[model samples]
Target: MTTLLGCDFSSAPSRRKAIVHAVGHVDRGRVVLQRQDRFESLDDWAAWLADDAHLPWVGGFDLPFGLPRELVEHLGWPTSWVDCIRHYASLSRQDIRDAFAAFCHQRPIGGKFAHRATDGPAGSSPSMKWVNPPVAFMLHAGVPRLLGAGAEFPGLATGDPRRIALEAYPGLLARSVLGATSYKSDEVRRQTADRLIARRTLIHALENGDPPLMRDAGLRLRLTHSQRDALADDASGDSLDAVLCLIQAAWAWQLHERGDEHWGLPAFDPLEGWILGA
Candidate 1:
């Protein structure tokens, strides 16, 4: 079986805000959690992924794999995935900020951000946004490693076939389970009882395969009592998000096994890649 992984990334990871990865697979209609690992630095995570033993794995990573096509076109960057990413990698953080700032400045106040086509369905922040979530920096920090690792991104780069990466948004999965209820907060003061309850509800939904996405595929999550508690108690939701991505990765891998073209993705713009389960 292909090793399945889900990654919750941090653009500027540190000991306090590490990247979380869930590693395991789906077996007998159940998504099993073998382990969850933490990496305080992207370099360390990259090195871990580069190990030969880690090949033949497919991962759903919570990071933007493509920029907004509108922004790329306005900047006159290459429209091809590899070329566009190469060009984006060459830019400094300050350079990216200036360019994105200029783009926002030219737009109307309420429409300051340029969004990718997938943003609507995925309900993700604009990939060009430089602050708050800082996903722009995530692409800057994460995509290069994926490229260098030769991970194949469907509809993007067909790199090392054994190592596949799909752009994923955990919010999409969580929202399906909890609707608009918020289940995570970085601020300790904001990690209220309501959020904790919501996390438990979300976990219950996953275990039952209540969502149509899971129900249709006959998939239910299997977690130990301790593992479930750990995911629910993580106020930042990084651990839960990693598991969500892992489920998404498993769905895509299942589709691939069934010989589905594009690995279950809809008709997508190659320059603006689609999220795996969106």
Candidate 2:
């Protein structure tokens, strides 16, 4: 079976540190077992994320799929940016660039374009950008790759929505464990120690059956002995990050199973599209 996947992402190479890890979903309650893949270059990463042969696993990637409604509408390409998005999906990379550029050229300063919060959570740049966070660059870098890879956009398309790709909020996962303590560690040396502790904390919480994490959620896990040990053993919550993606996947499944309309956006996003947690 194609299991769900969670990824701990980094735009930079990891010669000194692990760059990205695709944590695979295994037994009961995702005991992060195998590292699915890794990348030292964005080109290689983009190429991997775009491949269709590896999907149908409902990958909860740490990337933004849509721009803000405010930004899209402000640019005036299509009042119904959603519909425009559908059409935009069919365009080539160059075409998307030209159109998005035109949109920016028409807009004012301090507001080149708006971005999704997932951008920050995933460490990606604005979807409308071509530089800086280059999230616009990432979208340019990533989405077309998703399309090329034949990854389904459940929000936009109908077939194999099972290849489900959604914008995940890692903050949702981090907050559950750290509770707004600012667990993000960018200092290089501090990253390993911080990750190790976070993993320990989450394991402890999971063991005690923490309500927010274990009780209220509807999903269930069926972990093997090795799987369970692996989770606690991994110093970096790379496994946890993947499992966090899995939990978000479960949350998405729960909302969808609830018969949410408008692609589960109302429950997931009231102002934005289906945000995790609040």
Candidate 3:
């Protein structure tokens, strides 16, 4: 049995909004939810990721693993993914914002941000966007830690064989079930009855493998009553997102078991990583 991880990441984590990780393992066709871990600091999270005890695990992390190739090339940054990420990790957040702002300033309206090829299929925010989701900062903060942990990112970088990291987007999975219906919000004012209902609907779909993607992969979520309640009760959706990622990791692991290297990913640009299911 292989350990599996699903991570809902935050670039800047505080006690109020920390990184959430869903830890589990696949049993038969069921992805069992063992427990959830929260890290209020990046250092704690990084240390946990690097821990050798978690070896031989595959993780689905909700963060962009690479920048848009166009963005990298336009900035005259190193074209190699690993080197480019290293260069990116060295910069302060202010430097990243200024550079990206300048890049957007020269572009026309409705095309302010450069995107990766996976963006269309994955429905993810631009990795360079510093506001709203601030995924750009996510890439800035998250990737370096993964690299430091020596995690292997298929196609992009090679590192520890036992620890495999795949770029995952839970929104891609969630949107399939909800179809633009809002399910979660951080603000207490925004967390309503409808959103709670949506979360329940989503959980039901996962348990039944209702989505075509999940059904096709023969994956179902197995949660105890307490676990189910915990996932649904968290209005922030961080825990649910992590479980979604865990499912993605399980899907990828299934493919790997069947011996398709690159773990179900297509021939995507090495400079810009691909989402697992997308």
Q: Model 1: per-residue lDDT, tens digit, 26-101?
A: 8988999999999999899898778879779999999999998999999999999999999999999999999999
| Residues forming the 10-long window of minimal summed lDDT in candidate 2 | 263-272
Listed per candidate, the RMSD to the true structure in angstroms reads 0.8, 5.7, 0.7
Candidate 2's residue-wise lDDT over 1-278, tens digit each? Answer: 55566655543546543435444554444333355466767667667665666665666665555666666666554544345555555666677677677777777998766665544443445666655434443444444455555566664444355466665656665666677554334455665655656666765665444626345653444445676667656554555565666666555555555685432343332223334443
After superposition, the stretches of candidate 3 with alpha carbons farther than 4 Å from their true spots are none
- Structure candidate 3, residue pairs in collision: none
Clashes of each: 0, 14, 0
Runs with alpha carbons beyond 4 Å of true place in candidate 1: none
Off by over 4 Å in 2: 11-23, 26-34, 42-55, 78-135, 192-195, 206-214, 218-239, 254-272
Give RMSD (Å) of candidate 1 vs. truth: 0.8
Report the lDDT tens digits of candidate 3 across residue range 1-278. 57899999999999999999999988888989999999999999999989988778899999999999999999999999999999999999999999999999999999999999999998889989999989999999999999999999999999998989999999999998999999999999999999999999999999999877789989999999999998899998999999999999999999899898979899999999999899
Please report how far candidate 3 places residue 134 from its true position, in Å: 0.5
Q: Top model by TM-score, which number?
A: 3
The number of the candidate with the highest lDDT is: 3
